[model samples]
Target: MATIQEIKIDLEEKSMRTLLSAGTNKDCKIVAEGDSWFSYPVVKDIVDHLRQMGYAIKRHSKPGDTLENMVYGTDFGIATQVQRANNYGPISLKETLRSVKNLKPKFVLFSAGGNDVVGSELAQYLNHKRSGLPLFRENFFRDSVNGHIKSAITAFLEQVWQVDSGIHVIMHGYDYAIPSGLQYELAGIRFAGPWVLPAFARKAITTRTEQNRIIRQLVDIFNELLISLSNTYPNFHHIDLRGRFPNEAQWHNEIHLRKEGFEQVAKLFHQKMVEILNYNPVA
Candidate 1:
């Protein structure tokens, strides 16, 4: 088995053309796109673990990407703008689809929607405690998840099918996160997150129990949505990661897991991949 550093290809640092010329077997090639779960800067993430399992992964994920931007955003001048602002280049799912067409990878791993649900836009979905309304504006939350996120996912999958109908699309519902108010920091520099806590504070829902309940409900709903969406596509597979990291010790921060936890999650992904490849045996 190749080490993570040997198998993982950061797409930003290397061109797709160069990657193709490196003589990797297309059957073991994987294109991973989405948010920090796939590209966490502070620690080894799921993609790193998958690479150690022998997949040659071309990663196009960034730390704070949203499903909408990833699927619909263009490459033209957007990468420059995003790189200037975020210090990392933009993730273009269109470019990823093109890679899929060229590389003809057997599987595409997508990790998204977490940013869409818990990012800066989270406040929009919350109702103030003073309003005496539901914690979440249920209708708005449902509409955004189903209308925007789901639509973006569907669009990406449609493009993937066009590129290669036999390509398997693998997605994971992130495990339930603890809104512990712990922001991700590295070397005394705060990078990202405490994503859910501040929103809960602003809404005046400050109790730890209440925060846990709300986060669990949100994650559950998101996972259920993904599971339902997976059912509609013959080549799409959804990995249910709920309850996988049941302890606070497994989580590194609000939205990410510790390295060992991520490795465990990667094993689940590997298991699914093995099952698919064993049954189909990608030629």
Candidate 2:
């Protein structure tokens, strides 16, 4: 658990990109990388708060580094003797340990959801779409959708923990927001709505009927799997961010969080940290 002593924050929101002010936290470290809805603002906000507490912050993209020997010496299995470099060029565990130990983050907060809906197929879509393959839909196969998400998430968590098990890993799940509004045509091909629907409405559809059905099913399945994962993983905990703050609590983008909505999420997250990580804003 983290104390007012010092810390670091990693912002992982892949839905929207943002650049958070790295103000100051000589004792704490703040790591924020924004891309998709799963990145930035969300992560930076946390880092900003911790930094304000007199902690030094390390801002960087995912798969950051920490050198061996210098780390907290937790032997948390975070170090994969084999140097594995994530997208942002090459890095070593020794450097990662040094960075993390420097920031002294009590726990690691991983915020991601929504993007998986579109992300599940992003790679294939990119490749397929490039050649005009046309065989690309954000959510293609419902059956294996989560199996896809499961594999990706498991791999990601493995790397995160590998960096440092002593660092509590908080895996945030979807339902951080709810059906503030339907993502799009609820009826899939039919476009569920009174009247024969409006023109331009077709554009609001979720690809095709099969695609929509598969997407919805997969989202539900994925959340279920997430719940199970949380329960199974000792350090993993699911914050009950389900339901709505109010009818208007939803973002116009079907799944994104509105400003007020995000506020609610921030509060819940903060409270969770206070209770689980012994965290508090510096007075």
Which candidate gets the maximum lDDT versus the true structure? Answer: 1
> What's the distance in Å from true for residue 46, model 2?
6.8
Error of 2 at 94 (Å): 11
lDDT of each candidate versus the true structure: 0.80, 0.41
State every prediction's TM-score relative to the real structure.
Answer: 0.85, 0.50
Clashing residue pairs for model 1? none
Q: What tens-digit string does per-residue lDDT give for candidate 1 at 4-101?
A: 44434443334345346657666677889889999887777998877666666778888888887798773443356566533233359667987787
lDDT of each residue in 18-76, candidate 2, tens digit only: 21224432212333322222222322243444333333334443321111111222233
Candidate whose TM-score is highest: 1
Model 1, stretches more than 4 Å misplaced?
A: 1-24, 74-91, 279-283
lDDT score, candidate 2, position 210? 32
| Candidate 2 structure lDDT | 0.41
